[model samples]
Target: MPYDGFKDVKQIVKGDLEQYIIYQNEEVELKKFDNFVNLNDVLNEMEIHLKAYNRVASIQFYGITQDPETHSYMMVLEYEQMRIFEKI
Candidate 1:
C-alpha cells in the first residue's frame, strides 16, 4: 500500500539530495536509482515497521546515481528543527 497518510507529496520532493547516514548517524555508501521511480511507493515500502525516535519535520528522497548501476533508489528522512525531549 502507498504511504497515503502523508498529505503532502512535496515534503519528500522539495528537500535537496545528499548522502545521509543510517541509524546511529553512520555514513555508508549506498546505491542509486535511475528511470524515475515513484516517490510515494518508495517511501511506503520503507516505512514498514520503522520506528521514529525523534520528531520528524520533513522527509527527503535522493537518487544515488552510479555508472555501473547497482540498486534502484535511496530515501532520507529529515527531522524538524526543534528539540525532542524523551518522555522519561
Candidate 2:
C-alpha cells in the first residue's frame, strides 16, 4: 500500500558514488541509493529495515533515471506491491 504522507522529492545527499534520498514515512525511513550500489548489499540492507514493518512483503528496485533540468540521478523503490516512493 502507498504511504499515507509520501512526498515526491525528499532530502538529497550527494556522495562520491551515489546520491542518497531519504524518503520520509510514518512507519520508517526509506532510503534510495541513486548509483551503482551492489544489489546484494541493497537487498541485505532493505531486508533489515523491512523486518521492522509487518506489512512489507518485499522490496524491489525500479532502476534509475536522470533529471533533465538538474542532471541529477534518482533510484526508485517499490515496497510490498505498491509504488509508493522514488528518489532523485
Candidate 3:
C-alpha cells in the first residue's frame, strides 16, 4: 500500500457494508483486506449493541485483530468520531 496517500481511514468496504482500522498512525502498519467481515447480516443488531446517543456506527475494520497488549479477538467499531471496542 502507498503510504504517501494513507488517509485517516474510517471503514473497510466489502460491497455494501464497510469497516476500517480502529487506529492508524505512522508507526502502525495495517494490512487492508487481510480479513473481510460480512456485516450485512448483523450490522443492524450490532448497532443496537454498541449504539449511543442515537448515533449508529457505519464503520468497521477490514480485518479482525487483537490489541497487541490485550491479545484477544476484539471488534473495533467507529462512528460519530468515537471508537468502540467489543469482544466477540
- List the candidates' TM-scores in order: 0.25, 0.29, 0.24
> What lDDT tens digits, residue by residue, belong to model 2 across residues 5-62?
3445544333422233333542222344344246566556555544643254454654
Using lDDT, give the best candidate's number.
2
Q: Pick the candidate with the highest TM-score.
A: 2
Q: Taking the tens digit of each residue's C-alpha lDDT, what string does model 3 give over 6-80?
A: 346444434222444324543222322223245442444444444541344444333334433323233343333
Cα-lDDT of candidate 1: 0.32
Given candidate 1, what's the lDDT at residue 88? 10
| Per-model root-mean-square deviation over C-alphas | 13.1, 10.1, 11.2
The models' CA-based lDDT, in order, is 0.32, 0.41, 0.36
